[model samples]
Target: MSSIFESIEHAQAQLKELAPNQWNAFQQFNELVFKEGALSVKEKEIIAVAVTHITQCSRSTDFHTKAAKKAGASLKELVEAAFVATAIKAGGGVTHGTHVHNAKKTDASDFLYARSNLQNLKSIGKNAHEGFKGYTQFNAAATTEGMLNTKLKEIIAVAVGIATQCPYCIDVHTKKAENLGATNEELAEAIMVSSVVAAGSSFTHIAKMIQSYND
Candidate 1:
């Protein structure tokens, strides 16, 4: 079997012949999205790293990990960006426990109503509540004033929460980001970055599918 790295290379090679216009469009979009704007290139790359992890795209993770380094993000910064993804993703799961407590069936409405019941965990389930507290502490340490400041980290967290479809996480981090002095514009741009990266990830993988069909 070909390795993932080999497969990525194969996909790139095949795209030029199979879908040149798509390949060019993807390249242009990648360049434009990461260009400096309201957010710095480094910040965008950090968001890319976090979103790639949320999407579980190894190829994207590898690409953005390198891109982030080139943009002057330290190894510590990269890892912290990844931890933002970890915390928000885990928070998504942890927050869902509220639904079980309310005996509420899962749906969009559950996410809206179940979130308010999270505090009930403290009274109803001490151990799980304690674990959640520890997780919160970990999240605080991971995102607060590190190589990346709390504001940027929170923005990345918000974007990850959105990409992961975690409403609770999104609400929590959006407020946190606002508290950290992130403007609405910054928050919106970060979300757009996530949207572009998510779409790009799918576009890149079409080449993989093409290769599979040809094989």
Candidate 2:
């Protein structure tokens, strides 16, 4: 008897009709990503490559490796694209935590101290991938927003990855955004979104403090 995934693979191969739920979900999501988007076929393939990395979905990565080549992407370019994803991913972590902690304070109350504290947290987020899985869903979901035009949004996905701190998302979006034409300069610029919002979010601390005072 074959394993469940094998059965799905066989069904997927034969166009037969009996696959498992996880298998089905994967297949359905694959269809959605490929069939309906403003992105091109090669673009989607590259995104899929990144998705596999961020999701840490082994099979998805395998599929995209083949697909990217099929779509005419060079192996070296694909690797470089993935590198771009990782670099931005490293920076996004701090931006996210700083954003989170900052979003909780208001009126510059402890703004200076909080900025310092958050800087520490952001560093933790970036490196959390060494032995953690805190923010993959958060980052991966954000990475799905490939619809925007500015390179900033792409880097924002890295920031999201930082917030969530998932290596997989970091891997995928870094590459996907680049393949979508995010230059190194553009990639660097994209990360600025994290800085802007993270700093601004500190101002939200006011609302939190007010709510606490009322309580």
**Which one wins on lDDT?**
1
Candidate 1 on 1-215: residue-level lDDT in tens? 34867876877788788878977887887787787988999999989999999888777888889988999989988898999889888888877766665664444353445557767556434756677678779777778788889899999999999898888888889999999899988898898889888987887688678768878
TM-score of each: 0.85, 0.42
User: What's the C-alpha lDDT at position 117 in model 2?
Assistant: 54
Q: Worst ten-residue run, lDDT, model 2?
A: 194-203
lDDT string, candidate 2, 110-144, tens digits:
54433345444545556667533445454444334
| RMSD to the hidden true structure, all candidates | 3.1, 15.6
Stretches of candidate 2 exceeding 4 Å from the true structure? 1-29, 99-215
TM-score winner: 1
Whole-model lDDT for model 1 versus the true structure? Answer: 0.82
